[model samples]
Target: MAVSPELEGLRRIVPSRFVSFSFPNPFLGGAPNPYGDSYAGECIRVAVLDSPLPAPSVPSTVAMLVPAGRHRDWIFSTRAGHLHLLLSSTHVSRFIILGPELSAPSPRVVSCVSRPEPDPAHARLLPLLLALCPAAAFLGNARHAVPDVPLLTFHDDLLRLAPVKVVAGPVVGEMVVEDVAIDCAPGPVELRRRLRFKRMPCLVQTQVRLCPSSAAAAAASSSLLEALDGSGGLLQPEVGGSLVEPYLQAMVAGLAVIAPSVDESIQSGVRPTCLCAGVGGGSLPMSIRVGLQFNVLGVEADSVVLDVARNHFGLVEDEFLRVHVGDAIQTIEEFSRQGEADMNFSAVMVDLDSSDAMCGVSAPPLEMTHANILLSAHTILHHHGVLILNVMPPPADVSFYQGLVDVLRQVFSELYEIDVGNGENYVLIATVSPIETRVTDNSGQFLTELRKLAGDFLEHIRKI
Candidate 1:
C-alpha cells in the first residue's frame, strides 16, 4: 500500500507517545452490560442530494437510516433489493440507479451516482428522495457484495425546477412499493429530510451535510472505531454487549502515564495524585489496567451512568479509586475553585458524547458545537498533566488540525497527536512543562518521550 508523507510521519510519531496495549476487562466477575447494545440489522432511509442526482436506486444490501414513520407520506416496502425510483414528473434532470448483489453471504450494498432519466428537474429533487435497507431478507442470507452499480449524473442546468417531496410507506412491508415521492413545488427546499417506515423497523435516521472535511474525518474515525472493535476486548455481540469494559479498557490502555512520586517532594508542595474525569461506571482506564498507576479519582457527568458504571462495571468504591458524579464541567470548575489543594491532576480523559457531534440534531453550527469540548478539559488539567480528547479527526482538514494546535498551544508547553492503527483516529496529549527543569531543552525531551510512547502503543496494538 502506498503511504502519504503525513501518514508516514504520524506512524513514526505513534510509538514514541503511546505504549499501546489491550484494555483489561474490569467485568471479570460476570456483571451487568455497559455501553448498551451494538446497533445491528437496523434499516434506515437516506436521501442523497446534490446539484446532479446521485444513483437513483439504492442497493438492497445497503443498510440505510431513513427518517421516522410519523412525519410524512408512505413508501411501499420492497425486499432489500433494488430501490425503484418513481419520479413525480417527467422533468427529472438526472438520477443514478444501483442494483444489489451478494458476495460473502453478508449483504454488501453498493450505490453510485447516475443519470437514469432525462428530466430537467434534478436540482428540485427534495429530501427523503432515496431509501436504504439491509439485503438480508432479499438474499435469504446476508451477502457481502453487490454487482454492476453504475454511476451517472446530470450536468445540464434546468430552469424552473419544481420541488419533489419523498416519503416512505408502511403498508408496503418489505418487498412492496407505495407512495414514495410527492411533488411539492416552489416551497422551501430542505437540504436533508427523513421519514420512518415500518418495513425496516428499529432504525434511527440521520441526515448530515457531507463536505470534504467531514468526509475525511469520517474515513479516519471509522478506522479507529473498527480498530477498537477488532482489538480482543470488544464485547461479543452474542454475549449481549460484552464489549463495554473492553472499550473502556482500551481508553485506559491508550492513556498517557505519569510517573510515581517525585512530585510529592518538589512540585506543588503536595502529594502526587491522578485524576480521571468522565468516570461513567467504575472503570478507570489507565490506573487500573497498569496496576496502581496513580492515586486515581474518577469523575462522571451523570449519576445514573455512575451508578450503572459502579454496579455494572465492577468499579467498587475503593478509597484510591474515588468516584464522583455530577456535571463534569461544573465538577471540574468546583475542583479548580476549592482551594489549590483540589486542582492538581496527572491525566484527564474527556469522552463526553463519544465523538464531536451530537447524534440527534441537524446541521448545527460548528462554532457553538460541543465537538470542541476538549477546550474545557484543557483549562483545568495540571502541569505535566495529559489531556486525552476522544475525537475522530478526518484527514482532509488543515484547519481542524491547526485549530487543535492553536488550543493546545494555549495551555501546554508541547502537544503530540498519536494515531492508533493505520493512523485512523487520534489521541492528543498536551503535556505541561516540568517545574525545576534541569535539561537545557526540556520541551524537546517531552516531545521525544511522547512520540516514543505513542509509537510503542501503536506497535503493541498491531501485534495484538
Candidate 2:
C-alpha cells in the first residue's frame, strides 16, 4: 500500500492537525488510533461507527462510516471550504470544527479518492500497531499480551521528532505513523499471535458528486434501486447463520407467487407496496431484493428501535421505502378506515421478534395476540396480496402451527408454508390468490416463474 500521489498532494496542502481516537468496533478487538500525545481542543476525533456509539467527550468528524447494507459515507465540501459528512442516509451528523469553512463558487464539492489501506511494507505491522493501544479493555488481551510499554515508549520517541504518515490496512484505520514504517522502526514487535494480515475485500472509494439537492437525491435513489437488481435479491445471505437460507427461501416463495403480477404492475407505472412490521437494518434490503419496484412501508412499534434502525442499521426510508413507528395492527386499521387505498400494500410481512434474538434480550409482549395482529395486518392488503410471517413455533406442539393455519385460512383464500432451512423458524406465506406448480416443457424445466423464484425451497413448501 504505497502512498498515492493524490494523497501526497493532499498532505502537502493541509496544515498539520492532530486527531484523537474514539469508539471501537468490538469485532476488531481494540481501539484504532492512539491520541495519547498532548494536543489542544482543536484536534479532530476519528471514530469507527457502530451501534451504541462511544462518548467522544469532544466534537468529532467522520473520516468514514463502514456499517453494513447499502449506506454510503463520504466527506462533502462547500464552495466556502466548509466540509460536511454526507451519510448515505442523507442525514447529517453535526460536529463543530475549528478547521476552515467552504468558500468556493459551488455550494458543495465531492472529492473522490481511494479509501485508505494497510501498507504491508511495514514490518511487525499488525503486532506493532496492535501494541499502540493498551489491553485492559479487551477480554482476550492477557493470553496474547506482549510488552507494549516498551514499544509505546519507542513510538513516543519517534513522534517527538516528526509525525510519520504510515499506511496501515483497513484493519488499523489506514494509520499514518509519523516518519518511519513500523517494520523499519525499532521495537520488540513480536506477533506471537496466530492472526494474519487480512484486507477487507477489494476496496473501492465511495464516489461523491456534489450537486444540487435534487441531483444528490436522484443519485441516492438510483443507487438503492440498483442495489437489489444487481444482487439478484440476495444480500449477505450468511447473516443469520443457519436460518438465513430458509428465511430467504421463504421470502422468495412469497415473492415468487406474486412477482409476475407485481412486476407487471410496476412496469406499467403501478408501484406495488409491501408493509414490513418491525424494521431492522436488513428489512429494506430483504424486501427490495424480492421486488425492485416495491415501495416499502416499514412499521416498528418501538421508537428507539426505529432510531437504531436509522442511525446504526442504515434503514433509510426514501420514496421507495417508508418507515412508520406505530402498532402494525392499529395502523393498518386506521389506513383501512381512512380509505387510503393507494397506501395499501400488496405484501405484508412481520418479523417482530427479530430484535429480541438479534440483541439476545427479551421485552414484554404487545397487547394484541399474535393471531389478532396477523389478522389485522392482512386486512389492508389488495386482493392479490400475500402475507409472510416469521414465527417461532413449538417443535413439540404440532398443534401450535395447526392453530395458526386455521386463523389465516379463515381470511386468506389459500396458504403456502415453509420451514426455515435451519428448521428453527417457520415462514407462513398466505395469499388471497391461488398458486399451483405449472407444467414443464419437453426439456423438463419448470414452466412457471414462481418455481424459479422459490429457488431451493420449492419442494419444502406445502399448500393448504
Candidate 3:
C-alpha cells in the first residue's frame, strides 16, 4: 500500500519506528520454562529512516529487524511495572522520539471539540497516540501530574515509543505522523466466519478460588459506594455518554462483593483487571478497590469523548486504569501488538455488544464474528484464569455468543452462565483449565459454585 501524502508529511514531522515481536506456545498454560533465548534475545536488524539499522539510543528512533521463532517480548518487556524511556533520535517522527532523555521535547496536545466524556471503557487515547506519533513518549515528569488516573508506563532502555496526532485543522491529514506495529491476524480470521460462527467477546481469564462460605457473603451496598464517591454521592449521568462514574461505581461494587468469596475460596489472592466495551464515565469508581484494580478499556467513536473522560470524570488518578478511545476492533489490535502475550490480567469483564437479533438479522454477521476477541483474551489470560462476559438474552439469537461458549467448552473444563438478571446483560463466567485437556460440565460444580457467589448479588447486578 502506498503511503498517503498526508501521512508522508506527518512522517516527516513525526517518524515511525517498526519493531517485530513473536512468541511460542509450548506449555499452553503450564509452568514449563520458556525458552531462555526467548527471554534474553537480540534483534536481527534495527532499521532507521528507511535505512538498514543501528545501535540503541535514548528515545531511540529506529526500526528493528525481528527474527523468526522469537516473540516480541524477547526484545521489549511489555510486562515491566515501571518504565523510563530516553529519546536519542532527533528525526522527530510523529510525536515520539528515540533518545536518551526520558521526556519528549514538548508534546502539543491536538485540540478537539470538547467531548463530555471519553470512553473510559476502552481507553483509545493511548493507541491513537501511538497511531499519530509512534515516537511519542510520556514526559515522565508530567505523569505525576495526573494522580487520579492510573497510567501504564513502559520503559525500554534502548527506546521510547509514544503516539501523537493532529486533532484539528484544514490540513489535519497533512500532519506528520509515525507508524507503530498493529497485529491484525485475528481480524482476518474473524471476518471469515459467519454470524452464527462468530466467537464470543474476549475476556481476561482468571481462576475463582472461592471460599465455601462465599455464597453466604452479604452484597455490597450502594452506601459503601457513596463513601467512595465522597460528598458527591452518585453524580447524575452526564448529558452525552459519561458512563465512567456509574460504570466505575458498579465495577468497584462488584469486585468488593466478589473479593471476599475469592479470598475465602482460594488461598492465592485475586488481583483483577477487567475489560469492557463502551464509552462512558462509568468505570472510574471500579478503578478503586483495596485489593482489586482495573484496566477499564473502552471503545467509543469520538476522540473528544476521551478528553471529557479524563477532564470531567476522575479517571486521572492511578496507572491501573486507562481509557483507549477508539473503535473496539482497532483498540484490541494495538494491545496485542504491545505484548498482551506477557500480560496475565486477573479477570476480564466484557460488556461489548455482540450481534443484535432484534431485527432478526445477525448484526456482526455469522461469518464475521467476535471470536477472535475470545481467542486473544485466552492468549492473554494466566493459568486457570477466569473469564466473565455480559451476555444478552436468548431468542434474541446470540448464536454468536453460543459459538463462543462452544469454543470455550472445548478448552475450559468448566463453564457457567448465571442470570445476573433476567435481561440481555448476564454474567457469563469461564474457568480455563491449567491442563489443556477438556473437562466435562458434569456434577454441576461450576454452576453450584457460581450460584453460591451470585446469590442475592444477582439481583443487584440486574438492577445495574
lDDT of each: 0.33, 0.39, 0.32
Best prediction by lDDT: 2
Q: Which structure is stronger by lDDT: 1 or 2?
A: 2
lDDT of 1 by residue, 99-124 (tens): 11111122111111122331222222
Candidate 3 C-alpha lDDT tens digits along 1-464 = 22234444333222223321222222133322222222222212111232112222222222221211221221221111001011222332212211111111222221111111222311423232233322222333254322122122222211111122222212111111111121234532110000111112111111011111122221222322221212122222122111212222223333322343344334444344555544433333233321233344445444554444444333353465555655554555556556654356445555444333122212223422355656666555555555555554332343656676677666555565555332334455565544232222213333234333333443344211
lDDT of 2 by residue, 1-464 (tens): 22223322321112122222432212122333221121112222232221112222221222222111101111211111112121111222222111111221211111111112222212323332232222332233455443221111101111111111223332112321111111214653110000111111111111011111344444543442222222221222221111122464465555556655575676688777777765543433333534354677777665654544443333566677777878766776677667666856788776544222112111112322256665666667877788887665532234656777787788777887777665455777888677543312112222143344355665566666
Better of 1 and 2 by TM-score: 2
TM-score of 2: 0.42
Residue-pair clashes per candidate = 75, 22, 107
